[model samples]
Target: MARLLALLGSINIGGNRVKMADLKAAFADEGFGDVQTVAASGNAILSDDREPVFIETQLERILADRFGFKSCVMVRTRDEVARAVADNPFHGEGPQHGSDKMVHSIFLSQQPQQSAFDDLLELHKSKGSERLALGTRVLYLDYVYRVGVSDLSNKFLERKLGVKGTARNMNSLKNILSKMDAE
Candidate 1:
């Protein structure tokens, strides 16, 4: 079975607190092999040969049934994640971007259209100092400042893009990718 990463949304935040151990157990109970939770932020790596789409739906159901909250799970293959990292334009390659904590990859549920991306930028130009770039089922975000003070949010992004997604900082993503490769 191939190992994959599940980037879960709305986890450990906004009153949807989920213990990492319980989250792992939920996946294991659902028959996902080598279930492991990372960063306590709902990133899970598990071995399964099933399609990502099927796994996503199944995980969403599991979260609702086990934790009483709905979530969007973005399952990505190892290569897909590596590509996401490399595709990121603001990966601390220069002084123009913020630190790794400010750089994030929003794992989108579906590929957004070019027009949607344009509209998203147009709507967000005055909102903050963040920079955005569209990628393969991913939205690259660079918060020029602290995330806590930012006005941008998951709800706003979902509403503008019309798709569900989960955001992870570059540091967390790299740590998860390292663990994923070690196994």
Candidate 2:
């Protein structure tokens, strides 16, 4: 069985709450084993023999039906997550003016168009101190100063990319990978 990481959107925020137990149950009902939630923000790891895209679509449907709400799910394999961590452009760079938690990876449900990527780059250029890098389907952000407040916020990313996604801080991503390994 292949290990998969599911990045679920529109959950556990803004009054839309689903317990980790219920989330795990949903995956288990779908025939996934070793199902676990990395954090309260809809990050889950599971092992399955199906394709990642199929898993994502099925999970989205299951979540919508089960919770009476729509969720955009993005599924990635173990190696994919590893590669994303390895390819972080800010890894070797010196510490930012703020905490490491300021670094974030926005996992996109689908790869954004080149034009969208260009648009984001343009926005980054206008906003000094904030850096942006594009990965396989992830966008890395290094916010030097504004950790909680910035124009390059999660909503800004979704609007700029024209795709559904979930943002995880660098620390959160590392923890998710560690949990995946333990399972």
RMSD of each: 1.7, 2.0
In candidate 2, position 141 carries an lDDT of: 77
Instruction: List pairs with backbone clashes in candidate 2.
Output: none
Check candidate 1 and list the clashing pairs.
Answer: none
Worst 10 residues of 2 by lDDT: 91-100
Query: Which candidate's lDDT is highest?
Result: 1
Model 2 agreement with the true structure over 47-154: per-residue lDDT tens digits: 999988899889988888888788888898888887777787875452654355767777888889989999879877966777888887888877766566677767
Q: Rate the local accuracy (lDDT) of all candidates.
A: 0.90, 0.82
**Over 4 Å off, model 1:** 93-98
Q: Which lDDT tens digits does candidate 1 get at residues 115-164?
A: 98899899888878888999999999887676788777878888888888
Best by TM-score: 1
Each prediction's TM-score versus the true structure: 0.94, 0.90
